[model samples]
Target: MFSGGGSHACFRDCVEGVAMTCTYNFTITASTAMSYLCGDCPNNVSACSNPSCIAAGGIVRPVTVVNNRIPGPGIQVN
Candidate 1:
């Protein structure tokens, strides 16, 4: 089990053929702005530092994510 910086509970390594249960909780919040490295703008590494950079195509649009991660966490079961 993995946590993306949020509260979570998980169970793993259960005995084979045994019954087990796993539970997870997530918080939903409004979208937030985030900056990512721009491959094409190597000369302008600080472009995303400005809040308005998103409007100028220097940053990605605000988005809602789980545990502050785009794809969230992963779980495995046996």
Candidate 2:
């Protein structure tokens, strides 16, 4: 999930917004350093326009994980 369109723009604006899967376990006593910022989806490629980038060794955009879980038991169930 890479999104940063403030300077010029090359390839970093593919956001579906909403995804965290859940799975954390970090215990090291102390001494941390975590940072992540990517919020700029005015259009976000026309709201996710088909562009998975078939192949090329790299380039498979599509990331938006950050859910902490709360609506379990099959939400909506549809």
Candidate 3:
């Protein structure tokens, strides 16, 4: 089974029946955004425009992500 959301848990028991092969294709590209909440913050708000707002508050910079996800997608097999 294949799942997305950047979870690290195993999903072996989530699927039933015979085992099958799963293939996934991803494209990497350069992207820019106003802000990306990398971690916990006050009231879940962020000021990416501020240069000082790094890490938890996120920053306005070039980022490379998988399938347009920050933590990338998750893959599971059984």
Candidate 4:
């Protein structure tokens, strides 16, 4: 997954061939944001100082990546 946020993360169980084409987009006004794939996420995530932070409190939500099995055999298997 791809994010326009300050930071991002990605975990690959198997990133072969066309799997790389898969992408996700997100917008974060927060100063610090995180992305996790396969549940592997950072321990700390800093919240934004913008007005949005005040409204939602000092809590930044990390983006989660859920990958489904590809219909066809992946490069690794092939």
lDDT scores in order: 0.48, 0.26, 0.49, 0.30
* lDDT of candidate 4 over 1-78, digit per residue (tens): 323223323334555564544445333332323322212222323332222222122234533222211121122322
Tens digit per residue, CA lDDT, model 1, 1-78: 335333433445667687766666665544544444333342465654443223233345676655444455665553
> Which scores greater on TM-score, model 3 or model 4?
3
Q: Return the TM-score for each candidate structure.
A: 0.44, 0.14, 0.46, 0.18
Q: Candidate 1 lDDT (Cα, whole model)? A: 0.48
Pairs of residues at least 3 apart in sequence or in different chains that clash in candidate 1: none
Residue 32 accuracy (lDDT) in model 4: 27
Alpha carbon lDDT of residue 52, candidate 2?
Answer: 25
Write model 3 residue lDDT over 1-78, tens digit each, in one string. Answer: 234534434444545665655557676656653444333333355543243233322445777766655555667653
Which candidate achieves the best lDDT against the true structure? 3
Candidate 1 runs further than 4 Å off: 1-11, 35-58
Candidate 1 lDDT for residue 22: 66
Give the clash total for candidate 2.
4
Candidate 4 segments exceeding 4 Å error: 1-12, 15-19, 30-78
Off by over 4 Å in 3: 1-17, 35-57
